[model samples]
Target: MAVVIRTANWHSERSAIRSIRDAVFVREQKVPADLEWDTLEESARHFLVFKDGEAIGTGRLTADGKIGRLALIKSARGLGYGAKLLETICEHAQTLGHQRVYLHAQQQAQGFYSRAGFIVKGDIFSEANIPHIRMVRDLDFSSG
Candidate 1:
């Protein structure tokens, strides 16, 4: 399918990143614009997923090891691209000396993160009027 994942920053890939996020988080999920757009974009490392040379998904990892803003266009779901985006972000976090990575996963997507070795750490909380739970995964540094 010629899938590719590329590392990017806000200044370099803002439009592509925002397009996917807007489709998945804002337009599809109906999340508020104010809550979805944050100051973290300036510092967080971003990952963009492309299939057949077309941008389809994106995610970001913060300096503090928080992974968030993961979004995939509706047409791109269930094709395994999400997993690639997540693994890429986790690998980057490990390379940055992070011991673990955490994310506030939407309640329904908890199972998705769980399959990737994340475990729930706390009670469900509300964000942007959607239920979410904190999921964390420890990075294994011995492999690389």
Candidate 2:
């Protein structure tokens, strides 16, 4: 399947973006509703992954270089949407003068992030009751 990923407007696309995240995070992962939805959504840069015009995955990058709330539907897992979303967010961060992009990767997803150039930075911790590890990827802008 050919999937398209683009920067999202949280205001205009909130429902669509929320649907994907809610399904993956809240519904499936059992994340608390209060913790899953936060004020940062208004200020962060979000990305939505679409397959056949349906929102199937989403992620966000905050101004301070933190990438969070990355989620993809079960059918889309292992199909490259996750990596594509991460790459897009990291590239956007690079253009915004950020040297590195970091994220709290879920324990099971650590390998996925590692393959995308992120290295673990700290010991495991719990977020929304799920084990997570801090990972960081330095953007190499020397070529540009």
Model 2 lDDT tens row, 1-144? 668999999889999988988888999999999999998999999999999998999999998999999999998888888888888999899998999889999999999999999999989999999999999999995775
Which stretches of model 1 miss by more than 4 angstroms?
A: 141-144
Residue 88 in candidate 1, Cα distance off native in Å: 0.7
RMSD of 1: 1.3
RMSD each, Å: 1.3, 1.3
lDDT of each: 0.91, 0.92
Model 2 clashing residue pairs (backbone): none
**What lDDT score is found at residue 16 in candidate 2?**
92
Candidate 1 displacement at residue 9 in angstroms: 2.8
Model 2 lDDT-worst window of ten: 135-144
Displacement of residue 90 (Cα, Å) in model 2 is: 0.6
lDDT of 1 by residue, 5-108 (tens): 98977897799999999988999899999989998888889899988989899999988999999988888899888988899999899889999999999999
